[model samples]
Every structure is written in structure tokens, then in C-alpha cells.
Target: MTENPLKAKDEQPFVIDPIADTGAAKWSYFSLTFSLFYFFHIIAKYEQYTNTQLISVFVIYICFIALFFQAIRSTGKAVLKPIIAIVILSAVGAAINPGTNALFGYAAFFSGYYFLRKYAVLLLILNLAAQISSALILDLLSPYYLGPSLACSFSLFVYGIFSQKEYIHSCLQQKKNQQIEQLAAIAERERIARDMHDLLGHSLSSLALKSELAEKLANKQHFEAAKKEISEVASLARQTLSEVRLAVTGLKLQGLSGSLQKLTNELKNMKFDTQCYIDALNLPPMVESTLIILSKEWITNILRHSNGNSVSIAITTDANNVTLSIGDNGKTAKIKPGNGIEGMRSRVAELSGSLDINDDDGVKLTVVIPLLATVRSNVKNKAIVSV
Candidate 1:
């Protein structure tokens, strides 16, 4: 089966670790020259081994050096062959030269922490034994700095553990912040809009009715009630309409990001997993507001009609155009055009954008506006969902 690109984003680690991104120093990583430092140390005791033994050890050491940085940086299954080769080479290098284990153990320590964490303890133990056994075999155990050597590897191990924790914390923190901001933007406007609309309509209707009745009462010379009603009507009529109108239309949570974030939470409540890929770049007020309204309407329609559980909302911009797509796995073969859909079309048409609806096994609502050239700049098409 073909994997969905959207689901791949979910499986990625959210944290950007400083160490893993750039391994060692540039010169050290590329040249494979760091291993030679240990080679010279073993060579200082030159008479013990013949030139043939030295050359063979050199050949083995070079191969081990080649994978030094990669072992630390690449713990993926793709690097499995190199990792196995390096582990064998590390043991062989230790037999020829005890100091070689200390120099190369950095690779195993870091790889254990980041990629192969489940076996980190075992790798560390084996690495320590490699260092110690070399010293004992060469009768150089007393002279060897084995204690500090092991401690140095352990320090890297400790840092790796914390780095993993930091990555997890970063992921959780991002998710928490996304939910809070989305809820704050979504719920605040919804609560006030819904409550005030119901309350104001009832109040205005009652006030208008009483004022007209008061007008009749004044003709019958019931002056006191008439005076009170006329005064109240005069005060309330202009005030209610002006305030309610503003509250209903003016105070929408601005920007495409916040608005879409809120809509995502709404879909989540309806058992729909919504992924929104809104860019960090700001759009023009008109463009942003249009998308904000359009996306909300799309989600609202899907929740009302669909049985599917997944939706992906994405916005992409290039040098000449801006495209917004909302897709769902719903039954769209018999979609009835309503005011909401009409309004969505009208809104896009006003901006000289085309609104398209695809109704195959699913529905995909796409709006492309070529009129917003200034708003569309160089932006990547990759989906950065929430975090």
C-alpha cells in the first residue's frame, strides 16, 4: 500500500537537536584524520610490533576511522552494515592498540544514545570491556588511563539520554501550546457570538413591540407609559443594531493560522483528524480572511455530512499564485449546494480566485487565486502540521 505523506509527518520527531544536526567539526568529520591521533600513541611504543603488523593495523584503523562520524550520526537501519563493520573493527583495533578504543568509542556512545537507545547500556558495557581488555592483554593495564577513558564515554552517554528527553519534552510542549492557542482563539469568539446573538434578538424584538404599543397608548392619552417607551426605544434601537452588527461580523479571530487552528479542534471533536498546513508567512488581510472563512465552512460541512475521519487542509504560495486545498474522505457524490457553499464560491470569486469541488470517492475543495501576486512569494509546499 502507498503511504500517505501526511501520516509520515506524524511519525517524525518534533525536536531539532543541536548535536545530531552537525556532527563533530567539519574538518574532523570529512578528513577521517582523528583516528591517527591514537595511531601515533601506539606507534610511540614502536618496537613491540613488526612493520607488517603496523601496516595491517593501519589498514584496519583507517576503515574504522571512516565510520567514526557516521556511527554517531546515523543509527538508522540503513547504516546497519556500517555499524556492524565498525563494531567488529573497534574490537580488532583494541587488540592492536589499546588507545584506539578510547578515540573510536565516541561513535558507539553517541549512536547508542540517539538511534539504538534500547541497547545503549549493553553497548556501553561492551565498549568499556574493549578498552579494559586491550590494557590487560598488552600488560599496559597499570599505565593505561582506563578509568578516565570509561568516564569520558559515560559522559557522552549521559548527554545522549538527556537529549532524547529534551526531544520528547519539546514534542509534548509544542502539542500543548498548539491546543491552548487554538482553543483560546476558537472558543472565545464562539461563546460570545452565540450568547449575544440569542440574547440580543429576543431583547430587540420585545423592545420594538413595546415601543409600537406605546405609540398607540399615547394616542389614547396614557402619557406616562408612552413617554417611557418612546425614550427606551430611541435609546435601544440604534444601540442594539450597531453593537450586535459589530459583534457578529467585526471581532472574528484574525489571520489564517489561528482561525484554522481553531477549526482543527472542531473537527477533532467530530472524530475527524484534521491536519492544517498553514505557513508562517502572513497573507494580505483580504486573502487571509477569505481563507479563514472558507476553511471554517468546509469543516462545518464535513462534520455535518461526512462519516470519514480524516481531512487535510493545506495552503501553498508561489511566485504568481496562492492555493488553498481542503480534502476529506467523505461521500461527496451527492453534495447539495447550500448557501454556505454558495457563499464560499462568491467569496473566492470576489478575489478573482477559482473554487473547485472534486466529488469522486471523496471531496476536495480547492481555491486558487492568481490575483494575489504580491501576497504570494517564495514559500515551500511541504506540510508543517501544527508543530
Candidate 2:
């Protein structure tokens, strides 16, 4: 079954592995730094330069701050597009009016948003490219030196690319996990459907058919025989009802062996020599419940209709499927079609398994289940345990 989405195991609450944690931490740090730099830039830009003679410092400072924010934000595809657009727009504005400080300030804000909101390498690259392009296009000196600006921008771009790549990989991993969980959940639901049908349907149908026969006989001359039949049907109904209640109540959290033991006891109390022989096989809660319900209904049928004196049940693991067979040394009459039996057939179909009921000397019911339906490794292992 799928691990609980909202509730994790009590044994280990925080199960995020090192790689996942590292990615999250990296993203957080990137966002925080960008936020701080954005604030610092806003304050710095508003202040009047005390010494406007050395104006290159203003241009260089603004370029670094904007580059820092945009580089971090472009680590993911979601924010990469917007950041790239801003970078291009800023570069164009800078080229048109080379000496304007307003374009530099604007570019820095775009970098900050890209860094904090998304992980996209392209955003960082575009921002640095804009800075380099602007420096070359708006060179105040007669001679232009584009080499230094290009080198600095390229280095920052490379760093942002690596960070973005890691972030994307992490997201892909999480998505895969979620898909696996969803598949598990779908399988579990199918299993439950099959189990309920097998357990409840068979018992009710057998009881109903027997009860009808008893009523018919009562109207005829066989009054004693009719009463006997009616009594058996009544007992079957009561047992089935109890089993249904237990199956529904103990479904989510109960252990497999324990649920089976309860069923065995209930059957024994009703004077059916029901011997439960489960191998050292542990199963998931859902599988256990399904088996328990199936057992209850199967045994009830044997007692009421099969005229079986002793019943033996055996469960074993055969590769991926848990196989169960219930055999009895009782006489079998002509099997009649009923809703209960039909339901059992349907339930088995849901689990993608087969259920066969045979009557030669006595009635034998065999069930084949997939191993994936059960959680085996965690199950408590024990030899033959009887109740």
C-alpha cells in the first residue's frame, strides 16, 4: 500500500535524505542572500554619491549586486523566463542611455526576483550577459575593453547553471516518489473491494439460499428437517455478521495474524473444527483483512451447506502471490448459484487473482493473491501459531 501522505511513520518522522535536504537548503540560502542584497541595493541607490568623481564604483557596485540576485534565481525553469526578459530589457535600456543609473537599478531588482522565486540557470546567464553587453555598448572611454566584463559575467552564469541543474533533479525525484505512492493507493483500493465481496457476499448468499429452502420445507411435510435447516442458516447469518463487523473495524491498523486468530476463535465457538495453519508469512493489513473475511465466509458455507465435520486451512507464499487453501472432510451436495459465490468470484477478480471452489469428496476453496498486496519484510515472523 502507499505510505500515508499526511501521516508519516512514528518510527522516523523526518525522513528527507541528505540530497533532498541539501537542495532545499541551497535554494533557501540563495533566496535569503538575494533578499538581503536587494534591500541593500535599494538603500544604496537612493543615497546621493558623496564623491561623484569616481562614478565607476557606482556602475561596478550596481552590476555585481544585480548579477548576484539574478544568478541565484535562475536555477529553476519557472523563474528563468521572467529573469531573462528583464535582463534583455535592462541591457537594451543601458545601451540606449549608457550613462543612466536608472537602468542599472532596474536590472538589480529583476535579478533579485529571479533568484528568490525560481531556480533557472538561464535567468542568471541573461542578467550577466546584459551587464556585459551594457558595459561594452555604453563604454565612456574612447577605447573599449569587453574582455573583463565578459569573463566576470561568464563565471557567475556558470555557477547559476550548476545550482539550477541540481534543483531540477531534486524536483524530478520527488515527482517520481509521488507517482509510485499513487499507484500503490490504487492497488490497495482494488484489494479492499475484492476482499469485502468475497467475505460478505458468499456468507449472505449461502444463508439466504438455505433459509429459503428451510421455509419451503416448513410449508411441506418435512417440518423437522425444515427447522434444522433454518437453524443452520441462522447460525451462518450471525457468524457472517460478526465477521463483517470485525473486518470493517480492524481494517486500517490491525495485524494480519491477530485478525486471523480472532476469526479462528469465533468459528471454534460455533462448534466448527476450524484449524488455521498459517506459515511464517507476514502480510499487509489490507491483505490480512481480506483473508480473514474470506475465511469467515468460506467456513460458514461449509458448516451450513457442505456438511463438513472438520476444516483445515493453509496459507503459504508462492513467489509474489500468497496462496490459501481451505479443505474439509465433509459431504458436498449439488452446488447452486447464489449472490455470495458470485461476489467471491468478483472479489478475486479485483485482486487480479483466481479463487476456485471444488467439490469431489468435500468442498475445497483455494485463493491465490499477489505478494505486492502484502508488506512482508516488516511482518513478525513465527512458525505455525494456533489459537
Which one is best on TM-score? Answer: 1
Clashes of each: 0, 11
Q: lDDT for each of the candidates? A: 0.65, 0.56
lDDT of 1 by residue, 296-369 (tens): 88888888888788999999987666899999987756777789889999999888889988888689999997
What TM-score do all the candidates reach, one by one? 0.44, 0.38
Q: Would you give me the overall lDDT of model 2?
A: 0.56
Model 2: CA > 4 A from native: 1-152, 216-225, 246-387
Model 2, 1-387: lDDT tens digits are 433221224422111111223443455445434323323333545454344423544554455456534443443343334345545654554443333323333333333322422322334455555676676667732222234334434554454445534544444545554577678667766776777899888988898799889989988979999989988987998898877776565555345566667666756776778888788365654565577678777777765765556778888876688888988887857677588878877776777778987888687889997865223422211111110
**Best model per lDDT:** 1
Worst 10 residues of 1 by lDDT: 378-387
Q: For each candidate in turn, give its C-alpha RMSD to the true structure in angstroms.
A: 16.7, 17.5
